[model samples]
Target: MTASERMKMAAGEWYTCIDDELEALRVTARDAVFEHNSLPPRQRGNIAPALRTLLGAMGEGARIEAPFHCAYGFNLFLGEGVFLNAGCTILDTAPVRIGKGTLLGPNVQIYCAEHHREATGRLAGLEIAKAVTIGDNAWIGGSAVILAGVSIGEGAIVGAGAVVTRDVPANTTVIGNPARAVTPR
Candidate 1:
């Protein structure tokens, strides 16, 4: 039998995002996100209940500030002491793993889907999923955008407003558009 769209997506193959099953998953994520975002701060401790249930895995002490959003919550995995500040958005079309003690500043965006380059394919909603992994103790600054298939090494620092398009090496500091590694002055 042919693979379903979800299966194709999970396998990192090209698939149409407009499928009924995908829409259902998105609706589920939306509901969970709404619940997480709507609850009072006192009531939503660390990770909100609904969102905690929706995620694939969440380690102890993982905290997400309110107003966080994800396209599909099930593909997100967070390790211990992971802290995400307010207004973070993750397009988790593929697996997104944030390692232990990692911190994401406000408005950090993680995208795991790359849309087709062709205009006709874009019109058809064709896209391929790619996993994003942020290593332990890494710091992603505010307003940074991490593209699909990027693996951020442990202890790396991503400067504010940086657009990360390539893999970052361990303990490296990256800044500016396309995220080139920077040496200390």
Candidate 2:
């Protein structure tokens, strides 16, 4: 089997080769972060190598604050000049790709892993994995919950407390329970 296939097989139940590598990288990255105790400081993402592996371009002037949570980091990709503020959470069961110049407001939860509900009982721990993608220049407002297989198009804004179920188009502002586009800008 291919490396990716092996990783997929071992995502929830067991650990794959990629999973170990990602964990190591997260630990190293977390240790490298400086000035974590200070306030209002220019902060970068406090990545824990033991947590996961991060892919993509996290550019200069980007900041990802503390208490950020995620699954295997290898399935995640962050873009340049992106700011993931405090309390950001990502469950990257599949791949969670974030676009460039995006701003993630505080307490944003991006989850790609989904569970199946059966009549008798719930399926095993994790049912299946899906990918989540947020396009370029997008802004995810605070406390927004992005579910699996959802894509937020480029230049779109997801307002706070929104539960995004479908794909959001580019250059639009979406809010509410199901997250509808409010206006085009």
Candidate 3:
């Protein structure tokens, strides 16, 4: 049997992103997100019931501030005590796992989709997804951008405005574009 575009995407295989099925899913997610974002914080609590139902998994005490956005909510998993500040955006075409006690500062962006490099492929809307994992107790500073396939290790600290493109070592601190480990002064 041939795999559907969604299946191919879940398997990290290249697939055309512009598909009816995907569009419908995105629309569903948009509605959920809108509900979550539009409600008062007191009423929304940690997460709106509508948005919570849309997610794959959400541990107790997980909190997402208003203005949170994701490509597909089902691809996101949050562990206990995970806190996402306002304006966080996740292009979760693939799974995005956030471990327990992880804190993401405001405006953090996590991208799981990697568009095809060639112009023709771009025009065709071809892309592949890679899972992004953030280990327990990690702190991602404000405005950080985590690219596709990056694994942020446990207790790691990502400096503000950094662009993380590679795996971060456990308990390390990284800064700057394409994030590099910070050296002790």
Q: Which of the numbered candidates is closest to the native, going by highest TM-score?
A: 1
Task: Give candidate 2 misplaced runs (Cα > 4 Å).
Answer: 1-57, 119-123
lDDT agreement with native, every candidate: 0.97, 0.71, 0.96
Query: lDDT by residue for model 3 over 105-142, one digit each (tens)?
Result: 99999999999999999999999999999999999999
For model 1, the superposed segments whose C-alpha errors exceed 4 Å read none
Q: What is candidate 3's TM-score against the reference?
A: 0.98
Q: TM-score per candidate, in order? A: 0.99, 0.73, 0.98
List, residue by residue over 1-185, the lDDT tens digit for candidate 2: 55543365335432232345655654644443322423234432343333323443455555577756665556678877777888888777677888889999999999876665553323233245678999999999999999988999999999999999999998889999999989654
By lDDT, the candidates rank as 1, 3, 2
lDDT of 2 at 121: 24
Worst lDDT 10-window in candidate 2? 32-41
Candidate 2 residue-pair clash tally:
11
